[model samples]
Target: MKLKKPIASLVSVVLLSIGMATLVTSPASAHTNAVSATCSALSVDLQLYAASREGSPAEGYTEYQWTRTVVDNAAWTEYVRYTYTPKKHGKADPADASSTPLTDPSHWNADNKTYDNSAVDTYIHSGNGEGSWFWWIATTHEAKTHLETKWSKNEPAGDGWVKTGDSRFHETSPAVEAKTNHVAVTIDGTKVENTDFSTTFTKNYPFSDKYTSHTYSVVVTAWDDPMGTHGWTFTKSGSSIACTPPVVQVTAVFPEPVAPTCTTDGALPSLPTDQTGITFSWDENNSLKMVANADKGYVLTGATFNIYEKPGTATGDCYVPLEPVTVAPQTCQVGDGGVADFSGGSITLPTIAGVTYTVKTSGGEPVTITDGKATGLAPGDYTVTALPAEGKILTAGETGWKVGEDGSATITVTVGASADCSVVQPDSKVTSTEWADGTWACDATTVKQTREVTTTPYIWVDGAWVLDTAKAATVTEKQTRDLLASERTVCTEVLAAPPNTVVTIVPPTCTADGSATLANGVGYTWDKTSFGPGLWTATATVADGYAFDNGSTYQVTFLVSPKLTGGACSVSQVLAAPPNSGTFSQVLAAAPNASTAAVLAATGATPLPLAIVAMVLIGAGVVLQPRVRRAIFTRH
Candidate 1:
């Protein structure tokens, strides 16, 4: 009997990553440029650290826990996020008061979104309330919150929490202890009436969303004092040393889904997962065959499914005789005297089910049926179709029997069976393009490029032969991995670089240059600064095991070039080398800065000798000086 409601449909995922968005948990970063020039009057540099509370639910339980808190330094860090730009001597003119620089010898200011310690950041646990008393108490039914904040003029609060650290407020706080040791009541640079008295921060719970997936922005604060007792001794630029506070963001993800459960309830147990038991194996005749898991006692309803298919592409027509008298069994051809293959090339195997056979007359001649089955037939020739209780119908080929044939005429079927499909490639490469175990290769018999395994599987369960997708056999997969072909001795292509720079690449060729090559990373440069314009190339003297595609050769190309007398190039111009390796009209063969006479008299053997060229140009210019022309013109 079919289930009243499909179990698969009833199963729903409450929490979905449909849109797994990120919640910024950390505070907007604070910037500070504040460090007192001298510590003479600086009271102390105190660092207060606090942890952001984190909670998680126990597996399979509804209650959640505040396992531990991650420390958040930003709570106290924001107060002194002053940019410390010290004055030449003491402090800037508007020191500690104005944000910008002033000429005042000992003055400064801290602006730029400075923190206001005067007011408490009440909404520190903004939006999220996991650690808030309201949220925690709601779940635990507690009368009061265990967490506390307070200040005191008494000695350090020591190990135990102070119920009432000070008359200022009856609360538990870190600053309760530090106030005891000091002679003067001083926290940060602000002095208290008594060295004993110090103030602290307390929080009032704000309303938040009910517990669920959320981004909680909570800032916890803890105090660290040189006294090392307790209570906060917060300080600023005027009283503290230079320090940087780190900002960290924390995010929470929904827990994983619960595993499937099995119970004695009327509902069917979960179906077999992953087509582990369904398989197929071809008999000698290549007729349809299936190997699968039996339903045994687990099946509530019996399983019966049909397999339908046509001949494979290789076979033009599907026809396999039950007894091949005329043709060899192994080499039977399609359209021979046998049952033809299924219609769609392959059988559509459903969950395991019985395949029953019935013999009916080829043509429609009213035949009597008994007990909902074919019986008592005086047959001439009849067609037998394998009617699977579930999927498709399998052809049993045509049969001609005597009027009084025995049960041999009865249908044969395996109660529970799915598609059987899996193949094994030959250990070595083969010339065959398509083999039973699907493997597609490169060369006719050289390399195997890809291999695959495909199948459809089913397992018997809950009595009925329903589609066992979970038990379906794994489909075939094709994969091509790392291939080994020696690297060719060639450059792949030119790369981009800075102005006036070019690169040449040499592959670690297979067997051409032996091992004389460098380790693939060493680069060589040709100095052309003083040598006038000419071709320049950089080569590597190292060799590495990296391989290249196709047959390439040692190659050189320009990547960067600068100021071209004419042409579009990337790198800055190298005076000596030709901009690129091609012949062109009026290309500067030599450095343009070279002397004019040097170009006129330049030879391939040598560029103009630097010393000689300079002297020659200076001496020639003196003789051509125009002042001498005045005397000559006057004589003429």
Candidate 2:
């Protein structure tokens, strides 16, 4: 029973021991295999700091410090070393025993001395029961020295170096705290704020080791002020001081003003007035005279005497002074006195039947003459005189004239004749004896007579014909004689020749009756004779009383023209009547017999053959007219 108990206990012990060993070892083995598996799966980023060599100190030395970040696993811990070496037991041993110091193996210098471990192996084991293990180690795996370091020691410092406290140290020290501050900046006299300010610190000692210094920078944010802030306070390192802000300048803007001027409307005023006493004569009559009251005064500056008239009126008479005539002060006042004279008054005789009167005077008291004349003159001839009262003398006076008895005031006159009247009577009268003879006696006609008479009669005023009463008469007369005898007897006795009187007669010619007739002839009458006789005379008188034979009957002739024969006859003829055809009878004379009468008749009747033949042919042609036409037609 004791043996069984001991054996069972031993078995139990072995089994528990084996089970615990399996549990622990299995986990360790799994962890190691998982690490190797993770290393196999991860991408290996190999960075070398230095070549592998014998033992050396890993101070102030870096190989992969400048390299980029790479993926690493737990297997990467083998590459961390102080120095580099080769393999051990047919496997790489990055933590080699030969790279333990950083000094030379053959010599030693205390001033520049480093850790010396030359006498060492060149390889190191990596598994259980290997050489002494280190977290970082240098390697000499390829017969060359190499260095490796921790990743944190060989990274970039964040905020770079800065000036700080009494001792310079890496800001990563746990004893130091970080802070934030600001700096000021200005631009063109305006301010800015909230500029980023930062700095860094590093260690003073550990010359071979590098420390990340705190870095400071300005981000330069903007502000409302034009000038900006570029200053920093000692916030993180607390070592910076303050400074004065920079200055800037500027200018301003505005506006300006203006000026003024003056002007006027039109031309200036003028003046002209008449003088009182003095005859202020000028060479030119049209000179301008200053008026009594124009404006106050003349603006002679910048003005010329353009023209002259009244103020504000363009057209009055202008009297331009020969020179500039300045009026004496107060001379134009009212109630001033002056004088002119008219002294010597004289009369003159004109050469052309007229009169002239004149005043002869010189300068004296001012006075005028009243009405005055010279009297006591007659129509014959006279002379008159005049005398001036004061301050004068007569220069021309006496005159002469030729006068007449007529009532006229002229210096010369002529007389003319007066009117007269008269009557004229016949010197002798016709006698009674001449009237009693009973011929064409003008005295027996008893026609009243008149005479033209003229006389100058005077009325018995104061017993004589004084100058006012002369008168006259005038007459004229016409008379006629009466005849008591027959007109033929009167013509024979008074207007005929004595005994052998030869008379001219114009006989009658053809009339409308186609024969000459005495009733169609013109007749005449005569005046009575102073001595009686029985014979009578006649003449053929035209309707105007002109005798055709001119009262001489030496030969009697008549002109005749045939009248147109109408009624189956047409003839044109002219003839003349014989002279002395009418019978003349006187008392106690023998009668003419037939033979004498035939002679007389033959003489009186001379046949015109053309007229006779024209009548006869007209009668014959009228009788044979139809037969002749019939004979002509038969012959044709």
Clash counts for the predictions, in order: 74, 97
Off by over 4 Å in 2: 1-448, 453-456, 460-469, 475-489, 492-514, 518-636
lDDT of 1 by residue, 89-116 (tens): 3323332333222332232233444454
Total backbone clashes of model 2? 97
Provide TM-scores for the models. Answer: 0.12, 0.13
Please give the range of 10 consecutive residues that has the lowest summed lDDT in model 1.
Answer: 627-636
Winning model by TM-score: 2
- True-vs-predicted CA distance for residue 340, candidate 2, Å: 68
lDDT of 2 at 377: 17
lDDT of each: 0.27, 0.26
